[model samples]
Structure formats: structure tokens, C-alpha cells
Target: MADNDFVPLTPREGAALGDDVYAVLGEAILRGTLRPGDRLRDVELAARLGVSRTPVREALQRLERLGLVEVAANRYTRVTEAHPDAYAHTTEFMTYIAGDAAILGLARATSEQHTDLIEAVDALIARSERNDGMGILGGTTAFYQLLIRATGNHVFITIMREAGLALQRNLQGWTQPDEDVELRTTRYRRLRDAVVARDGRAAESILMEPEPSALALRGRPSLG
Candidate 1:
């Protein structure tokens, strides 16, 4: 991570201090500043982030739990490599979450949120047509964010928030299938219609459709 990128943390009480430290290190890892296999020294991080070693240790533990870091007691702590199967794994998790969130959120969404969902799906289709990988990823994430928030369930919101970093890192550069652009666009349109009608089941089904790339990855033999 760049030395100047972080500033010293002001005093805070309880878990908030550790939470702040975790967000800093977690963001660095997601942005590729602290790359896979980079050593994480508590003392160095503590000094750099201007916090005590305790919070640094706590942060690393949280990152480890999130699979962004790995630790070996008394030997070393380092960022973990993104496994070759990470895309498929994270995508599977995301599909299920998005599907369920759509069901619940559609039931509760306001008319304004319904309009937002339509626009979001349109953006997804537009990005797909342009074959813009990053744009597609961004559009898809934004759609899911709106849906999850519409649910107004703290548990769903917190799960997505906590997992958001890992999801972005794993799904970066995700694109709609170039060959299946027409098919994907059709599905996206259907999804938009489903949202307009507030058909929870229909929307959930569309959201749960597996991407061709994810299917291909799942079929590949395990590297392990």
C-alpha cells in the first residue's frame, strides 16, 4: 500500500477502532495495493495506520475470516491468493443472494424503487450490448444494491455490505457473454418487465439464471 494513502486514525472506542482498521486494510487488498502473498506485519501496519497493534491484529483476523488474508501463527500473515475458482464460487453466492433479495425486495419496494430497478436492468442491457466488462459489472452491482436495500432487512443489507469487497474483487471485469448478447438482453428485458409488474417470483428466476462463464468455470476440473 502507498504510505501516503493512509492517515492516522483519531481515537475511537470499542469495536469501531478495529472496524476502521479493517476497512482500511480490506480496501487496500481489494484495490490490489496489498497484493496476494504480501506480508502483513502488525507492528508496521499499526504504525502506518496510526493505530495500536491490537487493532491491526483484529483487522487482520477479520480479513482472514473474509478470505482476503491468511495467517499462520508465529510464522507469517499475508494476503491470500484469489483462487482460480473464486469467480465461480463468488458468483454462485451472489446469484443466490440476489435472487432471494429480489424476491423479498420486490414484495416491499416502493414505486420509485420499481422504476429504479427498470433503469438498472436497462443499464445492464446497454453495457452488455457495448461489451463493456467493467460497465456490466458496475451496472449489475448497482441493480443488486438497490434490490437489497429495498428489502429493508438489516441482515440482508449487512451480509451484502460485508461481502461486497470480496465480491467486487472476484467479479472484477465480469462481462456478459459476447455470443449470448441477444439472449442476455432478452432476459434483462424480461427482468425489467418482471420488476415493473412487481412479480417477485419472475424477477427472482431471472436473477438466478447462471452466466455462461460461471457454468464453464464450474465444469472445469478442480485445480486443487
Candidate 2:
């Protein structure tokens, strides 16, 4: 999907439809329906959503803020391609949130959360050991997601939480898949073990940089 779809949902008339718009339209964009540099028609988008232009406009505004849209006064709105600046900005923002959560997660995560995290890590390791694609990778991804939640930061957790589909798309684009999932699975263990040890720095480091060797199995590069 186009990066436009990552717009966070905003409440509208007491109903949160932004995610629906962002998710559906974003999926279309990712699947190449609404591609980068494609002009967006507000009225057309509203009609598609069966809503007024306000929500469409709001969604576009959020997308613009996210660096996924470019809007000109009374002229046009369009999806924008990924740029280094955008990536650096967004990744920095995400990393900040993640770092805070890592610190807090190490301190505040409950014993149950730690146990759940360990189990998830074990699952990931098993997948890496098996070294399979589309199956173990899928499972390992789920486990990584659970680790994010164990951090106990609700907002960042929510943001990363909704990123499941998006992450799948990104992984498919940037990561390599192989017959053996076990090596990749061990990365999860590394992160979890750090968390289990209450070493926030170690956990965050594992997150900031994963095992390149295992990632190479997927044969994809980093995404913007």
C-alpha cells in the first residue's frame, strides 16, 4: 500500500472511520491501486466512502502530515513516493517511542508479560530453526508483535499494533525468506532474553539492529 494508508485514525462524529479509510485505501495503495504521485480526488474519495468530504479531507491531511501526500491550495492532492527525509523522520519518531517503551517495559512489564514474551521468543526461534517461508516467518512476525505489546506503552503499542498488515507488506518487500526459519527465530529469543534479564539497553539494541545473517534469508532490503 502507499505510505498514505498509515495515517492514524481520528475520531469523527464520535465514530472512528479514519482507520477504515486509511486501511482500505492504504491497502489499495500498497497493492498498487493508488500509487505514488497519483492525484487524489476529494469528491471521488468521499463518494467511495459514502461520507462527506470532511473525513476524506481529514484523512488526506493526516496522510500529508505523515509525508505520504502532497496537497496544493485548490489544485491537487496526490500520493508521494518514499523519500529519505521521510524515512529518517518517521524512523526517528518510531525509535524514540520504541526506546521509551523498551526502558519502561523492562521496568514495568509484569511477570506474566515476561513469560508471554519468552514463549513468543521461543516460537520465533523454532520458526528460525525450521527455516521456512510464508509459514514460520508469519509466525515469527506474530511473536515479535507480542513482544512489542509486552512493553506496556499504550500509545506506541497501539501504533505498532495496527502495523501488523503494514509490517507484513514491508517484510515481504525488504526481508528474505528461506527454507530454515530457525536462525531467524533465534532473533526473537535474543530480544526476549534481554527483556527477561531486565536489560533495557540490550533489548533495545537487539531491536535497533537485528541479525543481518538471518534477515538475509529473505533477500529483501530495508524499506523507506
Candidate 3:
């Protein structure tokens, strides 16, 4: 591959060097700038990001745990290929967990939290309208993060983060450009109303609705 094929990454500017490295590398992988089977060498990444090998190593290990990267002992590390079953299973888990969180959130959310959730959903609607897949994903994640946090359960938050990462990875390049934006907006509006009304059952029901199949994964070969 040409040098131009690789996207340049800047040095860490945040206090959490490990987290900063992980975020940059993870976004690159999710955006397909780092494709499946692409070599991820600590020395190379450290140099590219102007970070030390320690943080790069830590970031790589974290990505490995998230199922985004695979490592061969003392040999190599590379991005993992997509697996349909893994995607399906992870989506299912995320949906259930998010539904529970929605219910809990509605029951526990303060007036201010309700306003924040509404804003997040509004952002999601806007992103969806423009068919901005990454923006939509980010907005949806933020909305759910609020809900998960409202539950006051650290374990659910952790699980959601892991599942959300896998879900986003599987959804790379997937967009419902022709899907009805109005319908989506209305559905989320109903969910927001339910949350505001503190209707736990309704919020869960709204959130538990089936998701469309990932057309992007339809013809892709699954990794064994």
C-alpha cells in the first residue's frame, strides 16, 4: 500500500494518553482507514501518534479485548474481520440492555436529565436526516449513555460500552439513506415523550422495537 493510504494521527494532547491513543486508533479502524488484517505494530503506531510504546501497547490491548483487534503472541496484531453472528449477537444484547436502561432511566431521570436526553435524540434525528452514519452512531450512543448513567448501575454502563463498540464496528459504512427519516424521528420522539412522562413500560417498548438488518454485512464473508 502507498503511504498515502494511511491516515496520519497526531500526538496525544489529553491527560489520558492511553485513552487518547485508543480513541484515535479505534476511530481509524471503525472508519475503515485501518482495514481487516492490516498490521498494527506498536512501534509503528507509537511513532505515528507521537506517543510512547507503552500507551500504544495499552491501546492495542484494549482494542483486542473489544474484539476489534486480534493479537498473535510475540508475532503480530491486526484488525479483526467482521463476523455476522458476532454482530447479530452483540446487537441483540445491546438492544436488551438498552431497553432495560431506558426503563430504568425514565424511572430515575431528573428534569434536567430528561432535557439532555431530548437534546441527544434531536441530534440523532438531525444526523439521520443527513445520512451521517458516524454522526448518527455518536448521537445514539450519547443518548443511550445518558440512559445507562441514569440507572446508576456501573456494570450496565460497562457492558453497554463494550457492546456499543462492537455494534459500531459492525455498522461501519452502513447507512439507511433511503429509510424513512420521518418515521425514525417520530419513533424517537415517542420514546422521549415516554421518558419525560416517566413511563418505564412505554420507554422500554419503544426501544425494544426491531432493528433493520445490516445490509452492509449481507454479502461479506464472516470470519471464522
Best candidate, TM-score:
1
Clashes of each: 0, 26, 0
State the local distance difference test value for candidate 2.
0.60
lDDT of 1 by residue, 1-224 (tens): 66786778876666488889988888888787888899999998889888899989988887887788899999999999888878768777778788788899999988888888888888887876766656766677788899999998999899778877777677654544545667766777788888888888898777666566321211232334
* Span of ten consecutive residues with least summed lDDT in model 2: 210-219
Candidate numbers sorted by lDDT from highest down: 1, 3, 2
Please, what is the whole-model Cα lDDT of each candidate in the order they appear?
Answer: 0.77, 0.60, 0.70
Worst 10 residues of 1 by lDDT: 214-223
Q: What value of lDDT does candidate 1 attain over all alpha carbons? A: 0.77
Query: What's each prediction's TM-score?
Result: 0.84, 0.68, 0.74
Per-residue lDDT of 64 in model 3: 91
Task: Give the alpha carbon lDDT tens digit for every residue of 156-210 in model 3.
Answer: 7777665555677764534434456666667767766776677878877876776
Name the candidate, 2 or 3, with the larger TM-score value. 3
Our tally of clashes for model 2 stands at 26
Q: Any runs in candidate 3 off by more than 4 Å, and if so which?
A: 1-14, 119-139, 162-164, 177-186, 210-224
In model 2, which regions exceed 4 Å deviation?
Answer: 1-14, 84-100, 133-144, 158-172, 177-190, 208-224
Best by lDDT: 1
Instruction: Please rank every candidate by TM-score, starting with the best.
Output: 1, 3, 2
Better of 1 and 3 by lDDT: 1
- Higher-ranked by TM-score: 1 or 3: 1
